[model samples]
Target chain A: MDFSSKLLEQAVLEMSQLPGIGKRTALRLVLHLLKQPEMQTLQLTDALSNLRTQIKLCKNCHNISDTDLCEICANPTRVKEIVCVVEDIRDVMAIENTGQYRGLYHVLGGKISPMDGIGPSQLKIKSLIDKVREGEIEEIIFALSSTLEGDTTNFYIFKQLEGLEIKTSTIARGISVGDELEYADEVTLGRSIANRVPFESSLKS
Target chain B: MDFSSKLLEQAVLEMSQLPGIGKRTALRLVLHLLKQPEMQTLQLTDALSNLRTQIKLCKNCHNISDTDLCEICANPTRVKEIVCVVEDIRDVMAIENTGQYRGLYHVLGGKISPMDGIGPSQLKIKSLIDKVREGEIEEIIFALSSTLEGDTTNFYIFKQLEGLEIKTSTIARGISVGDELEYADEVTLGRSIANRVPFESSLKS
Candidate 1:
């Protein structure tokens, strides 16, 4: 299309590469950004750039962070003896929003999907086991989704933690299912977290 | 709801300020951007900043450009005698995409509307009239949306050019209404442009 100078087209092309953004929407966004003050666009661009450059996986919990340890892990008030494990940073944000849980978080990065060639080793599972093996973590609450992959990942973690004195439990799956932690409103997610079931208790006294 | 990390929340707030973006979509977008490299975010931020600071509205057509005269206005081959008047830069893009027209353009900035307190005086209408008085222009095509406001603006321009011994016309109404030109596909818009009619040709002797 005969558009104004090539810069407009360049901005649109870059935006269109983002997930869920189509060409039309991208163009509209570029135009809208053009209408904004230069500072706002610069801030957004810097944030996106920092998301990749300044960020690295937290060695403790595997969450994206500006430092070796995520802000959640670096905080002093957070519970150090209990780590809530989840599939991604979005999940961490969902749990954090509730303000009901005070423990630190472990971002698994993603679930184990055999078809996608993902398995226990591909994720931060080894680091998770190491964290638990250090013996300070008294309880581990699993907040993964209830999809088949979620269950598989959970059980794998459960098996890996076997015979360890540390208590292990999976966050209740009653309110959430499939790849939907992103959509589970706070109340439902909180309820599930409160009702977490101990893996050892399920086997009997 | 009590959210952690004010920066992430701020990002969502700013994204939702866009014309069509909503809260959930903005959240998804922020998170997606977070997953990208810092360089990408920086580029977007830089582009946005540059979009406002470095870019200026072209002095002639009012199409956005980095210079006083946009690339379109500065180009020599485009026929200066035929001025295709459009409502905004988006229309300029639409006409350019077809690669059919070889005329210079005049972006009216917006159509006239008294209800919004925008009138012929508020727009670049004076500039348009000045062009007509110069006596070199043979045809002025109103490639604006066909609507009450568009037609109203067209009539206002037609009246301004009264007895100038020049041709004044409007883009066809077969495919446009109420500023819906932004949503129209290229083919329909192109056809409408090709089938335009003179404003008062039917009334003239």
Candidate 2:
């Protein structure tokens, strides 16, 4: 297709920047948007503009929010004594969808990665430490990924929480929910129960 | 994740309205947008908004343009005598990309879909007829799809061009390039060449 119109070309350029989307796909999407009613297309444009302009980081947890406090932080029913420390809000949502954790969230923003110029200072680690130091939290759960950076971040946090009696734990990794015990692959099933913990004393010395 | 943030929710909602995009994909895209640089995301938003604000249809050919006449229409090298009639600008672009034609184009805006309440009045058929009546055109090629509505629209245009000596033809569909010619099915290849004729005979009788 002729990429003539600057706005059309720009839309394609912007869309191509997205993962897995190329210039051709972006062009198709732009053309598709052109055919749609004005409101729908304008809404998408407004939504994109607002995604950056309107959304702010929650002061308490750093989860995306419009105000200083995210809904999770402002909620009274959520258990504040049990803090779930996650590398990102995505992890927080992943845990929350289980309907299992009623605890408050602590968004680290990112895992500590020294090689990539990302350190604890880059993340919201100081804020998390300050939240924990208030002494109201009873448990601090680590819900970082199984990556190397996740391990290092966990250790760093544990070191920082040195003098605290708060219970430290992590979510299990092997197998998954609704797994068939009989049909389970040997390594997967064996590792699932093997790595299973009591959720209280696990990840502790 | 809970789609609670107004901007995030709006982004998701807008994404969901796109063709082939569902709620899950919308959420994924919105979340992906969040990971991109703030400036990059804003560029896309601005581009989309600019498309509506800045882009306009060419008054002559009805093709999408940033000005009164599209670049294709303004290009002196393009053969105005061989005007390719398409259902939309997308069709015009597809032909342009083929690099096989050096002709001007006329966008019909849309096809006649009575079921969807689209009729001759909804399309740019009147504009096309008026342009053809000027008698400068030698060949008026039909580059619409072979779909039911596309054929219907083509037939309608063919009738309008009746007694006007301008030849009307269509883009030939064949086994794609790079496809194994030796392994090629003779029937499809034969049909391809047979269907392709000089612009005159296809429309005349």
Summarize candidate 2's per-residue lDDT along A1-205 as a digit string, tens digits: 4665777877888888877677877777888888877777778888887887678888878888878898888999999899888877667777778788888888887888878789888888888778778888889889988689999999999999898777898876676667768888787678788887687775452
Per-residue lDDT of model 2, residues B77-169, tens digit only: 888898888887667777788788898888888899999999989999988888888888888888888778998999998998898877788
In order, candidate lDDTs are 0.78, 0.81
TM-score of every candidate relative to the true structure: 0.76, 0.84
The digit string of per-residue lDDT tens for model 1 on A1-205 reads 4556667766776777778898788888888777557767766665455444555677888776657777888999999999898998778878887677899888887899999899887888998888888888999999998789998998999989998888877765555336478778787788778887788975762
- Off by more than 4 A, model 2: A112-117, A182-187, A195-205, B35-37, B113-117, B182-187, B193-205
Ten-residue stretch with the least lDDT total in model 2 chain B: B196-205
Q: Report the poorest 10 consecutive residues by lDDT, candidate 1 chain A.
A: A46-55
**Candidate achieving the largest lDDT:** 2
Distance from true position, residue B7, model 2, in Å? 2.9
